[model samples]
Target: MTEIINFRAGRYKISFHILHILMTEKYENNATQVPSSDDTLLGVINYQKVPTPIYDLTRILEGSSAQQQMSDLIDLLHEREKDHVEWLNALQSSIETGTEFTKARDPHQCAFGKWYDSFKSENEDLKHILQKFDEPHKVIHSLADKLLKMAATEGKEQALKVLNQQRKSTLRLLLNLFSAAREAVSSSYKPVIVYTTLNGATPSLGFLVDSVDDALTIDESDIQSFVNDQAIKFAGELNLPRMISGLITKDDVNSLLIDPSLIDASLPEAYENEASLA
Candidate 1:
């Protein structure tokens, strides 16, 4: 028998070997900023001032192509809204007789224009879709400020409790945002982030999940090799990059067992090779 950390992702009850789980931490704001190229690489988090890259495992499991499409859609929407605001401002200035408004190429090619075209075809309400972007950034910031004050005056334990509570609230708000975006685009997928270390390193990485369930032990007899499954093998080849080592069955549902070392493989070649030697 082997111990495992069970977590929920979509409708699946997934488990990782206990050895693979370094620790679990609350998701922080500094960790989730958008990255440059890789859609799965959400952003880096500071662990004791060491920057660590975070990966969206849910995106990887669902396949990168689909996630990329959704990410593009969201990006398009945000860009369109910004362009719309600028256009409206320009229109207002022209109406005030400041200057003549110059039309920028075809409006249909613009972000809002494209979104509007799709919205009309889909027959979804534009107001509701736009409203989904209203986030609680102010509330989150205020809570963060309060947390810092508590840390300075109340002490570590009390400040940690406050921080955890605030994190839960912030996570809930984030989930709402993600859920709203998915709903606006008619997608059913929902992703969450779990903080853990790769190969027992200092700075931890975040794994995108659907939801977290529980931690428990499993019988070793239930572990099965993934070598026979072509689909999983291919996923390992393309996305996870030698990450999936085996599968574990729990409640008749089989979940992939990931190797932490393979996650470390995502690092630069020099770092990965050094870590391997270490």
Candidate 2:
């Protein structure tokens, strides 16, 4: 059996031996930069009075990672919220001017509905919160047709009153649900950096990650080393970082195992120097 610490970086769960982790702390924008073409090198930051190289693993991986995805999802929810606000405005205009309702009548056919239908996640809490949105959203959309008919028959005053009532009740519920869902995800999306050293020397490197997940114990059999796999170096693809020694499969999730010394050796020359303050 072996012990490893798992950290989330974008879509991946990456790990290193627990001993390699000197400490983990929330990331700060304190890095000092040098002129460098490598985007992976996020400059150097101060750590316990020693200059440490700060690297963004997401950049090492790609642009699409957990942190970026979380940010985008939050933006998506806000956009959906805006859509409904406009829907309500357009609805009021339709009622006042006898204009035909311009928004879709079917809840499932609307923009937010379509996105909600396609959204997938393992987060049960988020799933539950979003599911609450369905009935209220449907009710809000269903109001247009019914309220318009009421306007023509019983006069606009009563219809507008019903519309405002629904906004206060159903719309209020849906918006609260949105806020809850956003908070749930955002709470867990906090990013941190795992501070590491070369052996027990200076705190030489800091890995910026989406979040630190868990400490895991697994059989040695769960690991597969691919550092020397030439197939990965085939023409269009870049060589796998020597520091990323292997993959460890636990509970069907595959995470990369990082080799600290080799990762230090792999640093771009730009990160070689300590910050002037150090």
Considering every candidate listed, which one attains the maximal lDDT? 2
Question: Clashing residue pairs, candidate 1?
Answer: none
- The deviation in Å at residue 13 for candidate 1 is 3.4
Shift in Å, residue 90, candidate 2 = 1.0
- The TM-score, computed over Cα atoms with residue i paired to residue i, of candidate 2 is 0.81
Cα lDDT of candidate 2 equals: 0.78
Q: Which parts of model 2 are misplaced by more than 4 Å?
A: 64-72, 120-128, 152-155, 227-241, 273-278
Q: Write the residue-wise lDDT of candidate 2 on 110-201 in tens digits.
A: 89999999998645578888888888998999998899999999999999999899889988888888899888778767778888876665
Clashing residue pairs in candidate 2 are 10-65, 10-66
Report the lDDT tens digits of candidate 1 across residue range 1-278.
Answer: 78887765533456677766665664444564532455556666655555656666655665553346556666765565455445544544443443555534344555544555555312134346544433443344344345445555776467566655644675456446545655665443334555555546564555766545666677877888766344543222224635667778777877877766666655545433332332
Give candidate 2's error at residue 52 in angstroms: 1.3
Clashes of each: 0, 2
Task: Judge candidate 2 at residue 170 and give its lDDT.
Answer: 88
Name the lDDT of candidate 1.
Answer: 0.54
* C-alpha TM-scores of all predictions: 0.46, 0.81
